[model samples]
Target: MQSTSHSAVLGRRKEPHTIIIARGDAVRHFTIRPWVATLLVCCVAVIAAGYLLATTYLVLRDDLIGASVAWQARMQQAYEDRIATLRSQIDRITSRQLLDQQLMEQKVNELIERQTALTERQNVIAPIVERVNTAPTGEESERIEKKPQLGTVSPDQSGFKASQIAALWKTRTESLNKTPAEKADLAFSTITKSLRHVEDDQLKRLESLADDAYQTADKISQALASAGLVIDVDYDKANVGGPLIEIDKSQVFDTRVRELNAAFRMLDTVKDQARSLPVANPAPGRPVSSSFGVRRDPIIGTAALHSGMDFRTGTGTPIRATASGTVVSAGWSGGYGRMVEVEHGQGFTTRYAHMSEILVVPGEKIERGMIVGKTGSSGRSTGPHLHYEVRKNGTALDPLRFITAGRQIQSYL
Candidate 1:
């Protein structure tokens, strides 16, 4: 009987547990396995952790956004405060020692504006001056380099010669015992005169640079024309129209700068065109076996029109493209075996003939000095050589003109 009672107790322990909810005369029961209860607790813990992580992410995001906005506002305010301080300094320098303070303020402000404009002009002129100093057109840059004043000063230091002017004015005005108004006017007059001298010097230097640029452009234009090609110097202009107003004499420096900039643009266009010309030798250090013109045919022994120059080279010597262009034709042709023809724009084309091996194919882009083929006498019976030709608008041109121009450009480059 005792054993039977012990077995009943063990069976109760193995069965699932019941969770009971009790109220006055009302009761409910929920049966669950121990493993199910454990799973429920774990799910509640996971949800609570997720909620905390999401809340943290939202709080941190708000903080970061607020910080970014505050940073921008701070920077903007700093810039405004700095600008205000500079204006206040200008006012203190102008209105501190004059009876007619209002009138002197206006005049001094105008002079300050002029000085500021001159200072900005100095920054613009600096690069142009440096370019002139370094430009390959030899002696002009040499002379400019010798002039110590042409080198650029710091932007703030340019045309702000207040201390020097103040000292000189104090000496001259102290003896006369000038009135405050007169003293202020005289001081401003001296500043204006000083700024004018600097502006005039800058204008003269720019004029000199513009003249030199135009001269270089002119020489390049002439050289190109000799090869029967003309470069269009007038690049496209931007759309611009405005109501005309009376010109201000104060704007003379700016107006001249605009004109000089326009001249430099033309010079740049000319230089680009010059670069595209066939101005490089196909086989450097090679002797010309035959010149372009009527020449005695090697096999037939009769005068024939030779449309190109022939450079004497050994078999398999490298032959390079004279200018950057696209290969218009390549491969074997009658009388000119294994030829590569390149079309450089502006109606100019170049041909390499008698090549034993063509390294480029039709429609391939080639850059200047790229090896296009190997030189060999493959057609019309001759020793190993490279036959090079320059043509414009389908008419053969003398290659010597281009070769000579190349030499001239090299001298400067």
Candidate 2:
């Protein structure tokens, strides 16, 4: 706390100061007060430091600016690289989505084609099914109907949409939170499985249809055999022609088609033969007076050799021919009055004896059931009756046999 004067302190610092400079051949000396010398030295030191600092700033300005610009460029490049990586990921996802869409569309198209083919097959087989059902009920009909049911799908149900499938896939993927590629792969697998199921069902239906066709053909063959006719069919004969490319290449289907063809051909041949064969009763709804065999003749009253059957009828009753044939003889004969004879094909012939009047002449064409004469007891008969005889190559046969055959075949025809 001692008080000191400002002038006294200032007076004490005013002390003498000295400086000297020497060159090679010259020497110089200078003297000054202590306060002045200190002020001068401080001023000179401040100016030198300022100049040095200004020179250093000038020298480093370009380098600092370049470094700042390079740092900014590096930051921008890093950002660009991040953006490119994100873009590549997006591209991959987009490509996978497109591929999945294409595959789904292809599966849908395949399902549609299979459905169309099944519909066509049904159409072709419907008529045959109806025909088989119309036959007489028995074991054969039961066998034909006892087949596996075919699985059917409507057009609307079979036409699966890509958008709908995609929606379903998206829903599942969202629930599982799977990656885009994983979702696409799972969706494709599901679609493929569904298509395979549909195709398998169609194939099974086709196989069933083929089996039904084969069964029908077999029945037809048996029916033809019952008619006493043989059908010789060439299975290798090609009745159908088309391009080499076939839509259906199944061996089972091909075999069934061939069987059906042969069966139909056999039926046609049997029908032709039935038309020409002699299988009609000459006297319908009439009682037989005598059977075809050795019997006592009423006129001779003895066990005479009887070669024909006789039907009891009133005089002038219509007599019809038993089969289609050409007239071989007509007019009167010794024991048979107003007799007529017909020569049918296949070594078959028929005779009508003891008729009231002969309506056919020699070499005249006649059909089965045609009115050929009138029934009467003529030369050697005691009562009104008809005499009918069937012969094969000039040998006598029982007329009753032919009539029985006609009765048996009537239902089938």
Candidate 3:
């Protein structure tokens, strides 16, 4: 059993081993690690085990924690989605509300601005109207509320913002469950409402004015009623003429029906005002150098009473008619050489003197603003100027008395 075993030594030499590898478009030489396969296998097994565990969990969790966890995840997802949706909706609502508010604010601001403009207009018109013998009251008590109408809107309020309009629509909907598209219709409605509400107050004012006018008419009627003049109320005709044109018959009767009648009867006197003179001058722009009252005479250098104004104008300046009327006198007068007299309607008469040229003939029909003659120092004057005078029924009056400023008169007066 004891046998000598002969051992054969295996020759071993340390050497580097090179491996060749090839890929598309490239070649390389490398050395391979001995444990690479084992490591790869370990990684693959781990992955497989993890997948198996997940699969098992899904299958087994059909009853307890797994299913509950899945359900909770779904619920959380749903909650997130819902939150996103609500946030989007809230943004939309907020945007809409903001837009609406802006529009409404714009409307309010413009409306207030328009109110101011209207107030300014009232100021201008009131002064002009005041100078008239009888003017309608612009007070809330006297003004009739026009029907709500588009035209009545303050100019500044014409364009309303969409948001504001939307808010207004909502309010209108709540008020009557309806809305209107036509601005004019809305305006008309508003005006009508205002007019109706102010009826009593306006009526009282109208009554007061009517009473005053009546008193004026009565007084006029007593003195001038015999002048073949009539101041009767006639809807068919206006004393001034035109549709809706009203005549203050009450005042005509109370103040001076006869005077009015005489004024009207002096049809020839009125005809004179509109006459075109030989030179078409009407004394409309004639400037006043001397006043109508007592003044020192420029030539005499002494205190003297003056009955008229001296209108200083360039030679040949056009004179115009103050009112529509006929030519009463176109000839020269004592101390008022080369004079023309026009009798304007409305109990008004004007005289132009020292005219270098006369463009109109006597008994000529003329309208207000017609040129009658050219300015010149033909009468008693120191320089090239026209002696101008205004008279009401043979009574001299200050020419400035008729110049009235008002919104109504801004365009003409």
Our model 1 lands, by Cα RMSD against the true structure, at: 34.8
lDDT of each: 0.80, 0.70, 0.57
Residue pairs whose backbone atoms clash in candidate 1: none
Which regions of candidate 2 are displaced past 4 Å?
A: 1-251, 315-320, 330-334, 356-374
Candidate 3 lDDT tens digits, 84-175 = 99999999989877876675566556555545644553453344234322433443123333322211333333346665888878766665
Relative to the true structure, candidate 1 reaches a TM of 0.60
Evaluate residue 178 in candidate 1 and report its C-alpha lDDT on the 0 to 100 scale.
82
Give me the displacement of residue 144 in model 2, in angstroms: 8.5
Give lDDT: candidate 3, residue 11: 44
Sort all candidates by lDDT, best to worst: 1, 2, 3
TM-score of each: 0.60, 0.53, 0.37
Candidate 3, residue 372: how far the Cα is off, in Å = 0.6
Q: What is the TM-score ranking, best to worst?
A: 1, 2, 3
Candidate 1 backbone overlaps, count: 0
RMSD after Cα superposition, model 2: 10.4
Runs of candidate 3 with Cα error greater than 4 angstroms are 1-287, 404-413
Give lDDT for model 3.
0.57
